[model samples]
Target: MGRLEIKSYEKIKEFLSEEHVGRIASIDENGYPQIIPMNFAFVNDSIYMHSYTRGEKLDNILRNPKTGFEVDRELEFLPSYFSHPTDASQADTLYISVVIKGKAVIVEDDDEKTLALNGLMKKYQPEGNYIPIKNNDLVLDEVAVIKIVPESIKGKYKIGQHLRTDSRLVLAKKILKRNSPTSRQTLKVMGFEETPDGLKMVDEPVW
Candidate 1:
């Protein structure tokens, strides 16, 4: 496993699309760091979130637009017991994560706000039962739409990427035996595939 750096924009976008919530970090008036989880939508190479027109987050953003955001999806836990019963400290969790360093700005344009809000609705409620958002909608004025334009975006996915070919095969078998949905996903992330003979590593492991 090399450094866990996800450099592909498409891969990061795919992971962002699957995730629902992201944590936004800001500096408060006292210069203390404050982090809040928000329902967010990633579109047009930016992150969008909605909040009350007035609040601590809004206040913080007004004072300083610079922000840090992160999103993560956990895969499975690997217990030390699987390798050595006595090495409890060796246990670790596998996961995919994305982090963003950006500047947050309140969207002043009604059209952009409508687009951002609609993107949120599509992400949270893809069934399409809700009414479309309009510029004249009463709720539009009451809610604040924040857009985060990323200065830097990074992603990391850890799933036995450092293991040797034989070791990865053994882990893949174990994951399959576990037969959980996450375990299945773990196999895919490890780039394992089923062949007529046995399991095969289709892609190079990514850390």
Candidate 2:
């Protein structure tokens, strides 16, 4: 199936909100690729993440500001046996992925740091039970906030968007029979809308 791209800002933001972790890639001093997983917050069309005051990531960023970040959510696994009975190679997983090419800047301003930390708290702990971050907090000195301003952002979803109507219907029925949460989510991503009569397929799937 052909890959589907998401170009809508709102849709991209929604997908980013649904994902909590992202992989960030940078170049180390040796000119080697350094990739690490990080908890991130998406706000104001920028990505914010925190780290210790000193780390390999910080060192890499100091040497080079250009970086790549990616976030992805796996929907469901489609086994080849379920479709192409003879070819295991046909097996694949459905997922939504977003990639960002951006410049990373260390946040030194107290107000900006506080705002970024607040954004992180709101994202991971909407329960609002923790103490609010303050500029005077000693921990602020120990932590480093990094903000990524994206030069380009691209999103892709592999959820059977290229499937023909009849094939899509069969897949939807299979997904329903499976009845797992992931299956249900996959159905939604595949543009299967529930109607009074039955599940209706849309011409375009939601990426």
Total clashing pairs for each candidate: 0, 0
In candidate 2, stretches whose alpha carbon ends up further than 4 angstroms from where it belongs are 1-3, 179-181, 193-204
- lDDT tens digits, residue span 24-78, model 1: 9988999988999999999899999999988998889999999999999888887
Clashing pairs in 1: none
Candidate 1 residues lying further than 4 Å off, grouped into runs, are: 179-181, 193-207
The ten-residue window of minimal lDDT in model 1 covers 1-10
lDDT of all predictions: 0.87, 0.86
**Model 2: which ten-residue window has the lowest total lDDT?**
1-10
**Mind giving the per-residue lDDT tens digits that candidate 2 earns over 53-169?**
999999899889999999999898877866787999988787889999999999999888998999999999998999989988877798999999999999888777667778878
Distance from true position, residue 159, model 2, in Å? 2.1
